[model samples]
Structures are given as C-alpha cells and as structure tokens.
Target: MPLPLYLLALAVFAMGTSEFMLAGLLPDIASDFGVTVGTAGVLTSAFAIGMIVGAPLVAALARDWPMRPTLLAFVVVFAVAHAAGALTTSFPILFATRVVAALANAGFLAVALTAAAGLVSPGNKGRALAVLLSGTTVATIAGVPGGAVLGTALGWRATFWAVAVLCLPAALGILKGIPAGRGGDEATGKPALRAELAQLARPRLILVMLLGALVNAATFGSLTFLAPVVTDTAGLDELWISVVLVLFGAGSFVGVTAAGRLSDRSSGPVIAVGGPLLLIGWPALAVLAHEPVALFILVFVQGALSFALGSTLITRVLYQAAGAPTMAGSYATAALNVGAAAGPVVGAATLGTEAGVLGPLWASGLLVAVALLIALPLHAVITASRNTEVQR
Candidate 1:
C-alpha cells in the first residue's frame, strides 16, 4: 500500500470514532442531559440519517471541487462537531451538533473512498478502499469499546473531546502526505450527473442498488438489535455482552482484511459464498441463542461473513459503473447509512411482537435469503457484462 493509503486510514480512524462513539455512550449522554437512554440512542439514528442524506447531496454539490480540500474541509467540519458535542450541555444543542457532525462524517467518508480509489492504480482500487475502511473495522474493535470504558470513567463528553483531539493530526497528515491532483477536481469530467442518473436508471444498476439495500438490511437489521436481545432475553450479563460485541468486532476486522484480497482475486465467489453463509448463519445464530457457547461462535462467524458481502459487492459495482465509479462508491456508502438507519426501526418493530429476541434475527435471516435471491441476478448481470466486455 502507498503512504497516502496509510494517511487516509488515520482520517478514517478519526471519523469512525466520532461517528460510532455515541452508541456506547448513550447511557452517559442521557444521564448528562436528563433524558432517557432511548432518546440518547436517537443520536446514533440521527447520525445515520445525516449520512444517508448528506452523502449524495454533498457529492452532487461538491463534485466539481478539488478533492483534497473537500475531504479536508469535511474532516474539519467533523472535528468541530465533536468539539461542539463535548461542550454542549443542552439536549437540543447537542443533538444539533450531532447532526452537523454526522453530515461531515458522511461526506468525509464518501469523498475519502472516492479519493482513495483515485490514489491507487486501477487494478488495486479494491485494496485501497479496504485499507481505508480498515479504520472503521479497527474503530469497532478498539475505539467503541475504549470509548465506552472512557465514558464510564471520564464521562461521555471527555470521549468526544478525545476524538476531536485526534482529528488535528488527521488533518495535518492529509495536508502533508496525500499528493495533489488526485482529488475530485482533476478526476471529475464534464458534468455527467444527469447522464449518470440516466445510466443508473437501467435495470442493471437498479439491481445493484437494490442488492446493496437488501444486503445492508439483512445484517444490520439483526446487529442493531443484537446487544439488547442477547442481554434482555437470554439474561446475559454486561460482561458477556461486551465479550460478544468484541467477538463480532474481531470477526469483522478479519473479514474486512480478507475481503480486499478476495475481491482482488474473485469478487463473484465472495458474494456467492457470503450471501448463503448469512442465510445459514442467521438461522443458526437464532437457533443457538439458548446455547451461549455455541451462539458466541455463530455470532462471530456471522458478523465476519455478513460484512464481507457488501465490500465484495462494491467491487462489482465499481466494475460495472466504470464510467462513473465515484457515483457507485457514493451509492454504496449511502447504502451503509441507510441500512444502519433502517435496522433499529425494523428490529424494534419486529421485536414488539411475541416473537421476542429471536424474532428480529429470524427476520434478518429472511432478509438475507431475499438478498441471496437478489445476488443471483446480480451474479448473472456481472457475468454477462464480463462476457460482453471480453467479446468486444
């Protein structure tokens, strides 16, 4: 990997920490603001909402700007939001800060993925994204848990302050390390927004987008509810919850690392293998819920495989949308936020019934199965496209 890949990793680390810290700090934030933990949880949802909306919106608006400045500007915006979050005492003000922070968070990542892809040779783009996204995986492994512990010890405000502190070095690294002329400004061709939109209107791109949505819904739909269900229904302690969460995070780290290598070689097998694995694992994860040891193993495996699907899928989208790869990247990133935002809502509604904790996981499994059905068509589309390209 290049030095720029490493520098972008730092920015990803900072952004990932800033974006995900709230999930572990919800209780502390609620206590600090005299609100319910439920309300504090909305902060996570708020951030996801901002990402879903801000990604395409910002990409459309700033498609013409020089890439480095735009990426750096978003990082600055994110840093300021964290600082503001640390300082605010009122709920409304803090919530506002979170929304602003999330917009910056979303935009920064969308731009970074595009920028990172631009930095590398064409054949190595998948590795580049995986490396940049490794920060997100690492954040899940270290940052969130550490932030939770820090929130318990130093207060939630202090955690945000810590994240804000890291952003300074990230900005400096980008400024000094990343080469010029590799940003959106130079890469962006004539205004192809309408043309790209027309292209996406084709059945193939729509299938890709739909597959992105279904895959996201399948995994996050269950994951968002995992902690609550495992603890509340299974009568597991917080220690076990932390352990399970760590296991999931660890599995994800391994999966993300492997995804780059796998996609670099054969993206089709990754998707074909991953989708059905989730179909199997989700059901098994729910069935083994009563067996703690077995469930732990299943959760780890499921987390690892579930995440690998989307990253693998992204390479296919990039290949298909060769003329406007950044738009494909933008859509994939936005799908992430959209899935996260939808997960809790879907899980909460499903869990409201008598089906209880297992209900959501089962529902998620069904969604994955549906995604598998979608992936079949996607695989055909990719195969046909490849064959066509070869013949030409």
Candidate 2:
C-alpha cells in the first residue's frame, strides 16, 4: 500500500472513531442536554443520514475538482466541527455539529476511496482499499473502546475533544502524503459525471451494491443488538459485553486483512463460500444464543465471515464501477450506509415485538437469506462485468 492510502486510513480512523464512539457517550450527552437517551441516539442516525446523502453528492460535485485540497478541507472542517461539538453548550448546536462533521466525513471517505485506488496499480486496488479500511477495523477495536474509557474518566466532552485532537494528525498526514490533482487524474480515464452516473445505473452495479447492502444489513443488524445477546441471551456478566465487542472487532480485523490479499483474485469465490457460511451462521447463532461458550465463539467466527464477505463485496463494487473513477467509491459507501441505517431499525422492530436478543439474529438471518437469493445468480454477472472491464 502507498503512503497516501495510509494517510487516508488515518483520516478514516479519526472520523470512524467519532462515528462509533458516540454510542457509548449517549447517556452523558442525553444527561447534559436534558434529553432522553433515545433522543441523543438520534445523533447516530444524523451521521448516517449525512453520510448516505453527502457521499455521492459530494463525489459527483467534486468529480473533476482537485482531490488533495478537497480532502484537506474536509478534514479541517471535520476537526472544527468536533472542536465546536466539544465546546458547545446548546444541544441543538451539538446536533448541528454532528451533521456537519458527518458531511465532511462522508465527502472525505468517498474521495479517499478514489484517491486510494488511484495510488495503486489496477490489480492491487482491493489491497489498497483493504489497507485503507483497516483503519476503521482498528478503530473499532481500539478507538471506540478508547473513547468509552476517556468518556468514563473525563466525561463525554473529553471524548469529543480527543477525537477532535486526532483530526490534526490525520489532516497533516493527508496534506503531506496524498497527491495533488483530481481523484480520477491517475485513472485509466476520467469520465464525466453523467457518464459515471449512467455507469452506476447499470443492472450489474446495482445488483452488486444491493447485495453488499443486504450483507451489511445482516452484519450490522446483529451487531447493533449484540449487547443484549451477550447479557440476556448468553447470561453473561455485563463486563463480558466489552470483551465480546473486542473479540468481534478482532475478528473483523483479521477478516478484512485477509480479504485485502484474496479479493483481487477470488472475490466471487469468496462470496460464494463465505456467503453461505453467513446465511447459515446467523440462524445458528439465534439458536445458540442460549449457550455462552457457543455464543462467544460464534460471535467471533461470524464477525470474521461477515467482514470478509463485506470487504470482498466492496472490492467487487469498486471494480465494477472503476470506470467511474471519482464516482465509483460513493456507490459502496452509500450502499453500505443504507444497510447500516436500516439494520438497527429492523432489529429494533423485532425486539419491540417481543423477540428479545434473538430478534436481531432472526433479522440478520432473513437479510442474509435475501442477499443469497439475489447473489446466487448475480455471481456470474459480477464476473462478466469484471471480465468486461479487464478486456477494455
């Protein structure tokens, strides 16, 4: 991987920490703002909404704009937003900052994907992306937990300040390490925004993205409710929740690391294999939700399989939309976020209907099953598109 990819990953780490660490601080935020915890949770949804809307929009608007400056500007804005969030007194003001920060995070991510891909040779695009995504995985393991600890020790404001401080190093890294010029400047060719949009509209790309979304829906759905599973279902102590989260994160790190190496050659094959594993794994997890040892082990195993499959799908989407250069990465970001936003909703509904922790598992199973039904035939379609791209 190139230095720019690492720098982009660094930026992603800072942004990702803010994106997730808020979950642990919701109680503090709610208390400080005199709002319900559920209301404070809306900030997470705001971030997701921002990412979903801003990713493609920003990428399209900046399709031909210089990437380096745009990326730097996003980091600066993000840092400023965090700093404001840390210092603000008004809850509405804090809400506004989260939205602003999310917009910048989405824009930076979309552009960084393009820039990261551009930094590597065509064959190693998947590996480059994996390197970049590793930052997020590592953040899941380290940064989210770190934020929780910081908030516990020094209050939620300290967590915001810490995340704000992280952006400085990321901004410096991007300015120094990432190259000048548009994200498409180094690609085989840069298509106009219209052409890119047309390419993205293709059935092949849509199916690939939808499949990715469904996979993510399952992954995130189950994960969003895993705390209850660890406690009520597995009958474990509350302390084990953090351990379970870390184990899952560790598994994700391993999976994404392996996906980077394997995706270029066998993304389709990996999907074929891992896809079925996950589809079955979810239901099995629901059934095993009662056994602590099995629940723990399967959580780790499922995490590895889910991320391995998710990363492979992302690589495939990038490959399928590579013709769009600057626009390609947005498809993956938007699709995954759509799933991310939807997953918890589905899980929450099941719980509301008296499904308990097992509701999330059932939600995951149903999602993966639907994804499998769609992907079963599209496997050949994805291969055909990739072959077509290579032939071009």
Candidate 3:
C-alpha cells in the first residue's frame, strides 16, 4: 500500500533477475570455464545455501538496525557482487560472487517481508506479499528474457554488468522510499533471539514452513535446470528458451495474482487444491517432454500451479510465525531458501545420471508428492476447523 512496498518490489525485481537469469547462462558459463553443465549448477545450489544460512543470521543481526539503511546496504553489496562476477575470470570467483549475491538477496528479502507485512493491516498481508513477489514474476517476463538476449549477444558477463546497473536505481529507490526507522515487525526493544528460536519448536509452524520448503524445492528444482529441458528433452531450438521462460513467467503472474486475493480468505482450500494439481503437473510435464507444444503449454501450467502453491504456503508460514513478528520473516525466508537450496541439488544429481535433462522433472514430481502428502491432511483439518468456527 505504501510507496516503500513498491520500492521493495522494485529491488526484488533486480535481485530476482540475478537469480533466474542463471538458467540461460549455465551453458555458456560451463563452456567458458570448461566444466560440465552439472558442475555449473552448483552455483544455483551455492546461492540457495547462502540464502538459507544468511536469512536468519542477517535478520537477527539487523533486527534493531534502521530498516532503510540496512536494505540499502544489502543492495549495494548485491550490486558489487554482480560487478565482481562480471569481471571474474575463474568459475570459483564467479561462484563466490553468487554466494555473496545470494546472501545479500536473503538479507534483503527477510527485511522486505517484515516491512511488507508491516505496511498493511492484518488482513492484507497476502496481497502485500503478492505485490512484493510481483517483482520476481515480472522478472520472468521481461528481466530474464532480456538477460538471456544479453547473454546470447554480448556474453553472460554483460548480463551481470546490466544487473549491476539495474541495482543502482533499486538502491536509490530504497533510499528514497523506505522509512527512516525500524518497521512494526522490527519491535523497538532489544533483540529477542530466544523467542524467535522458540517459534521454531511450534509443531504447526514447523509443518507450515516444511510445506513451504517442500513446494519450493519442487518449483525451483525444476526451474534451476529448465534450459536443458527446453533445448534437449523438448527438442526445441536454443531460441525457444526465452519464449518458454516468458510463458512460465506469464503463468506465474496470473497464479500469484489469484493467490494473493484468495489466500487471505481461503488459504487452506487453495493450498489443498493447488498442491495436488502441481504434483500431477510435474509428472505430466516429464511424460510429454518430447512434444514441443506440450512443452509450451505444460510449462505455463506448471508455473501457475507452482507459484500459486508457493505464495500461499509462504503466506501461511508468515501467519504461523507471526507470534514472533521480530524474527518471523527470517524464519519464513530461511524455510523457503531451504527448498531453493535442495531443489538444485536434486536436479544436479539427476542430471548426473541417465535421467539427464529429464531428471529434474522427475525430482520435482517426487518433491511435490512428498509435500502434498504432508500438506493435504493438515489443510483438511484446517478447513474443517474453519467450518466449525463459522457454524458456531
């Protein structure tokens, strides 16, 4: 609702493009460094791992710090990481930059989530989050494709340089837009690290975060290796990579838009329906990998289902951990990045085997199924409890 919310989204767009653009750059990166594609994928996992570790750590450190300057500092670090990455000569140097970039991304997202939910009333958190995430979905449509083209024409380093430039405006936006002090969620007292850790032991909260991690694992696991799936399994030209990615982004926009509206009202039901459909969709995508048209249609379908599922799961996690508003954001972010980290590992492992490019799809299907098995009954109980409350 506030100008800062939009600015946060703008910053997220630049970070997200850095994250997703790797899909298109993987082949080129691998070739440049004389490594296997699977090896190059370690960059994805490394980034996720950085986020997984950094989210909570950074959030805890910055809990009492002024939110605006903290956010701006992270953006500066992110931009510098990209500049270093663009100038990197070896894979190891580039890999270190990815880790640094991801750490900054994790810190920014943790603070932004807290700031976003704090901007609106209790009921609008979902929509607020959706607005924040819109930057990421929009990145798929425009930023990612643009990065791919840049990577294709001028070299992957150019895309990194462009990302660095993009971060400049985002940093300015943070400086201009964000308030001068800590937000509502960043309580004014001394840090309560113990209370935040206590939130981790709650059974329901743990389950919700697990669901978040699992769904994202499936979503990102498949996404991390999408280029190979497009070029190899689908038998499409290299040119089609951006097209399919755009389609996926378009579907994701629609999905997150709908989920933002529905989640506040019917999180349980929406999560219930979306999870199973995604579990089915992942396997279906694999089966039809050989068909170009099926590839196009299914990716969109997968994107919609995956993001809708992801958004709702995260919104639910936020609510579940809201008791510790001080650290809820860091925990939610860590949970999601846990999945982001693991997903690529699965994709990379499968790629190493006979599954090749198709391996990621199967891994995604398995991840979703596990996530659904855990989530379905929980939502069923939630739905019934809500119905009881209404009847009473």
Candidate 4:
C-alpha cells in the first residue's frame, strides 16, 4: 500500500472513533443532561440520519469538484463538528453537532473510498480500498475501547474533546497528503452522482442494498444499547463493560477481514454460514448476558459472525448490478447508513418490553433470520444472471 493509504486510514480512524465513542458514553451523557439514556442515544441516531441524508447529497453536489478540495472540505467539517461537540453543554447542541459530524462522515467515506481506489494502479485498486477501510476495522478494535475508557475516567465530554484533538491532525493529514486532482473520477468528464442514483432502479440491486440495511439492523439493533444490558444483566461495572465491548470490537475486526476473503472465494457459502451463525450467536448472547464470562464469549462470536456478512452482501449487490458498479457502491453505503439510523430506534423500543435485556437480542435475531430468507433466493439470481464479477 502507498503512504497515502496509511494517511487516509489515520483520518478514517479519527472519524470511526468519533462515531463509536457515543455508545460507550450514552449513560454518562444522559446523566449529565438529566435525560434518559434512551434520549441521549438520539446522538447516534442523529449521526446516522446525517449519513443517510448527506452521503448522496454531498456526493451529488461535489461531483464536479476535484477530489482534493472536496475531501479536505469534509475533513474540516469533521474537525469543526467535533470541536462543537466538545464545547456544548446542552443536549440539543451536542446532538446537532453530532449530526453535522456524521454528515462529514458520509462525505468523507464516499470520497475516501473513491480516492483509495484511484491511488493505486488499476489492478491494485481493491487492495488499496481494503487497506483504507481497515482503518475503520482498527478503530473498532482500538478506538471504541479507548473512547470507553476515556469516557469513563475523564467524563464523556472529555472523550469528545480527545476526539476533537485527534481530528486536527487528521484534517491536516488529508489536506497535505491526498494527491491533487488524483482522487475520484478525473476521467469520463466526472460522472454525475445523479447518474449513480439511477442504478437503484434495478430491482436486484435495490434488493441487495436493502439486504445490507436489514442485516446491519439485526446486529446493531441489539448492540446500540449493549452497555446497559451488560451492566444490568451481567452485574458488571462500567469498566468491565468497556473491556467486554472491546472483545466485541475485536470480533468485528476479525469478522470483517475474514469475510472479505471469504467473499472473494465463495459468496453463497459465506452468507449461508454467516446467517445461521448470527442467528445462533445473537440469541445465545441474550441468554448468556447473565453470566459475564459467558456473555464475553457470546459477544466475541456475535461480533465475528454478525459483521462477517458485510463483504458477502456487498459482493452480491455489485455482482447482481454488473454494469453499474458505482451506483451499487452508493446503494450499499446508503443502506448501511439507513441501518445505522434504524438500529438505535429499534433497540430503544425493544428495551421497553417486559423481556428487558433479552428482548433486543431476540428481536435482532429475527431480523437476521429475515435477512437470511431474503438472501436464499439471491444464489439462484446470481446463477441465472452469471453476474458474479469481483466487486471492489
């Protein structure tokens, strides 16, 4: 990988840390603001909303801009949003800042992926993209854990301050390092983002994107409120909760990397394995939440299997789409943001039930099963279309 890839990864690392840190601090924010934890979770929901809205909007608006200026603009947005988040004492202000930060996230990732792909020789594009996205994977493994510890010790605000500080270097790194006019489409007279939107008109493509949304909803719907669930069910302190959650992040990193490889080899088998494994693991996690050791084991497996489906699903979408790969990418990303938005809302609602800690997990498993059912026919579709090209 090029040095640019590492530089982009550092930027993504800061962004990922900003995004996931909220989960660990939801309780703290709630307490400080004198709001319910469920209410404080709106911060995450706001971020997802921003991603869903901002991804295409920014993509469309910036279609004509050279990638360097566009990405640097988004990086600045991220830094400023984090700074605002760090300074705000009011819940509404913090929430708004989170939303703005997430909007930056949407644009940053779209540009980053495009840039990463462009950074390398045509044959090595996939590798570049993978290396760039690994920053997110590393963030999951390291950033979230670090944020949780920071939030617990210095207070939640302090964690956001740390995130803001990280953003400064990330912004500068992006501005200085991204090759001028070398990122995104410098040829074909700049593909209009509106052209990409047309790809959603394909039914199979749309189905695959929706599938990504549903799958993520299944995982994060239960996961968004996992801290409280662990606290109450496992009788663990905040510190222990953070540690176990890190185990979950560890599982996710393993799952994402392994899934990417598995998809390259066989999509059908990967999804088949992922579906049942997630179905079994999620519900088991719910049952095991009462036992800390058991819950840790369950979370590890849950993280691993749940995220393992990502690359497989992305491959399926792109394969089915065939001719319109860029549109397929946009759809996949949009679906992901939609899932992120829906997860917390669903989790909050589920937690209100009498089943308490176990409710969201059961609900999440049902969502996964539904996703599997949707995916079952995808194999036949792929066979009929013969569209299984390697998707970036």
**Backbone clashes, each candidate:** 1, 0, 0, 0
For all the candidates, what are their Cα RMSDs to the real structure? 2.9, 2.6, 2.6, 2.7
Tens digit per residue, CA lDDT, model 3, 348-389: 899877888989999999999898777766775433332342
TM-score against native, each model: 0.88, 0.90, 0.95, 0.91
Task: Please tell me which predicted candidate would have the highest lDDT against the true structure.
Answer: 3
Q: What would the per-residue lDDT of candidate 4 be over residues 216-291, giving only the tens digit for each residue?
A: 8777677678888778888888887678768878887787777656554455676777788888887888877898
Angstrom error at residue 145, model 3: 1.5
Instruction: Sort by TM-score, best first.
Output: 3, 4, 2, 1
Superior candidate under lDDT, 2 versus 4: 2
- Top-TM-score candidate index: 3
Q: For each candidate in the order shown, give its overall lDDT on alpha carbons.
A: 0.72, 0.81, 0.86, 0.73
Full-model lDDT, candidate 2: 0.81
Model 4, residue 340: C-alpha shift (Å): 0.6
The deviation in Å at residue 15 for candidate 4 is 1.2
Clashing pairs in 1: 67-184
Candidate number with the higher lDDT (1 or 3): 3
